[model samples]
Target chain A: MGVLKAAWWIARKDLAVEIRSRELIYTAMFFAVACLLIFAFAFVEGRTTIRNAPAGILWITIVFSGTLALGRTFERERQAETLRALLMTPVERPAIYLGKLLSLLILLGSIQVVVVPLVGLLFGAPILRAPFMLMGLLALGTTGFATVGTLFAAMLTRTSSRDVLLPVVLYPMSLPALVGGMQGTLWIFAAEPNYELVQTWLAMLVFFDAVFLTLALWTFAPVMGE
Target chain B: MKLGDRLIVVLLAVSGLMLTASPYVIDTAPYEATMGLVQRIFYYHFPMAMTMMLSAIVCGAASAWFLFRRSERADHIAVAAAEMAVVFGVLTLITGPLWARKSWGVWWVWDARITSTFIMWLVFGSYLLLRRFGGAGSEVLAAAVGFFGMVLVPFIYYSVNLWKTLHPSNSVVPSLPTSMGIPLYYCWAAFTLLFVALMSVRIRLERSRGWLERAYRAVED
Candidate 1:
């Protein structure tokens, strides 16, 4: 219960910061929108390909926007050594992780709200069919990605090239999320009942999250040693 | 006394040379016209692909170790293993495409195996690039990437088994007759040794370079 309180405090603090600045949400939305606009125009000569390729463009935008948000989010901790200070508290490592991850979900989820609509408008697809499953998969997939990515961000924070290295490694690790998320979204756009595929991919994502998240917990103490 | 590792190295060097010249020395059944002599690229290409996968696996294991023990040595080994993987990856990519060009009309295809392999390479390569700029203790960074890259490899290999696959079937694995399997295993063993030797040498070099950097810094201090 105490750990939960600490976790809640951290989450609230992060939300408060974002609310005050509003930079994280606004910038991520802009990049996502701009990506769709550019991809739409670039494939002007190939409308057939564009129709087929909107899936790729949509994913590309989410991935890039996710990276941007993740980098800046961690960069905040790095600048202030906030993660280290957080460690000094009595919270369980996983609680801190879960808390930060929940806040990340909120932030990235907001970006998705704007990004998904923008994608729906540009791509002209029926993405709202089975809305709960669609949103559930996205949430699961992004949580898995952010869980591992945030762990790496913690490790790389002490390094000099944190910015470049984080994405290079983080993006690769998140391929399952990329595959599962894209496939789920594709199903949503197809307006078909593919809840089975959604469950299977979500299972894959949960497995990945469990394994890597444990690894991060085991290393966090050593990674941020006193 | 057991023969020193260098003996193994010399034996490997000799075996590689022989495999390189096997077609001229032995008069086996003539390869089909379409494949011809170029088909020998198959021997090198398959082993290189196997070795690249092996390298990624090593990186993954080492990464797991780093995350577990937080030993700098494990981190160094993980990073070293990943660096070694690049050469094998390049060899596979180059020779596989070359074989493809000869086998099919085009230089590349959108086949599952090829795509997955290419994606794996990008993942590892990008992971390495991240390490280069990640400053000190970059191994943890690389390990995270390596571990994740490995997750995709089994899917790539068994993708055919999972789906009604269309790519070229894997012929080099078990269940082949001895004539082909023997030579193939010989070549596989030799290439794996070559990979180990390369990794050892590279790891030594990296350690020395780090030592030199630290020594210079201490002198200034």
Candidate 2:
């Protein structure tokens, strides 16, 4: 099969399994909600406080829960011993990475769907003002997160301390994406949002995603060696 | 030890003495019009920062070599360089806050260089953590982290620069007065010598440990 088709097939497989089990989806959503509630309690002194800091809080929630989701998703493959089986197939390695990344993006995207609305409700963010732009920024940011996260998850699959190592490795590498996402989201939330600053941050997110995805692709094959 | 190892040890000793004497040298330099005596920390602070940056690059390069060659030597060098990076990074972190406290009137400020160095320090710290706790094939994974970290240095620098920050971003060497410049260079030379000496010794230790592991495995077999 062609690489694209093979990748789509693998992504479909993961989605089908997830649809059947609903284990990763339900747990990730619960975690994301829990994170939002904790942030609300910790930082939300009043309406003004939540309104002022919604973007930072939102992104932090996503990052923390996203790390959790990545770990759990990869744990399934490792537990089933399916990763080795999949590798033994003739499917291209990069295709496997892309497939995994795509599924993670879908998983994270669903979490965002619920979390973004809750952020708007709880923090009174002006998320609706620039809805499409905000979605674009979230998509870009999540793509970057999943791209690197999936690669690292694969690399750490055989490790004993994978749960701890995943976030430790992921967070520093994903800092630029997180910062850019937070900045863009902040712009979206502001009453007098600066178009110029938003654009610049969006461009940074794009650049980071492109560079890291390429690097992850190259590094994945070697890191996941026999 | 071999003649070269002895030479490195002697050079390390001489540089150690120079570093010890550096305080007096810095004291004699004309005080900055703005910061006064507290500015003397710059001599040690600046060199430690340089050594930390150099060690990061060296570690990254060694990691790349390990990825390409899969040689035990490259892995040893990478781990050794990472350890040194952490050591120097800690020194830089502590000295930077001290200087910042006196100069900026704050214990810490999210300045571009400061933030980048802190992030870089964390990256190397994680590199060491993965190696220690990752279990089988951890070196390969740590090597991957090193390679990504090397790639990240410039990105982190640019991103932090693009963001607004309060730290001074001037070129210290080019703008330095003669009085300050002399001691700064002396410290730089001494720190560089010390880095080389430490890396060599650490690499030797790693090699011996690897040999011992192999011998033990052979006996078990």
Worst 10 residues of 2 chain B by lDDT: B166-175
Give fnat of each prediction, in order.
0.50, 0.73
- TM-score for each candidate, following the candidate numbering: 0.84, 0.95
DockQ, structure candidate 2: 0.65
Point to the candidate with the largest lDDT.
Answer: 2
Tell me the interface RMSD of every candidate, in Å. Answer: 3.9, 1.8
Instruction: Count the clashes in each prediction.
Output: 0, 0
User: What would the per-residue lDDT of candidate 1 be over residues B1-221, giving only the tens digit for each residue?
Assistant: 33645664675576667667554433353464767877667667788888998888888788777766776677767777787677788889999878777676568765657767777787779778867776666666566667656765664334322221321254322221234544456667668877777776666667777789989999999
TM-score, candidate 2, is 0.95
Q: To one decimal, what is the Cα RMSD in angstroms of model 1 from the true structure?
A: 4.4
Instruction: Indicate the worst ten consecutive residues by lDDT in candidate 1 chain A.
Output: A43-52
- Residue-wise C-alpha lDDT for candidate 1, range A1-226, written one tens digit per residue: 6767877888888899999999889998898888878877875454433543555667788788888888888788778878678777777776776677778889989988887777667676555766777787778778777877777776677788777777777765666567666666665565344576666656765665666567666655555554
Q: DockQ, per-model, please?
A: 0.41, 0.65
DockQ of 1: 0.41
Model 1 residue B108 CA deviation (Å) reads 2.7
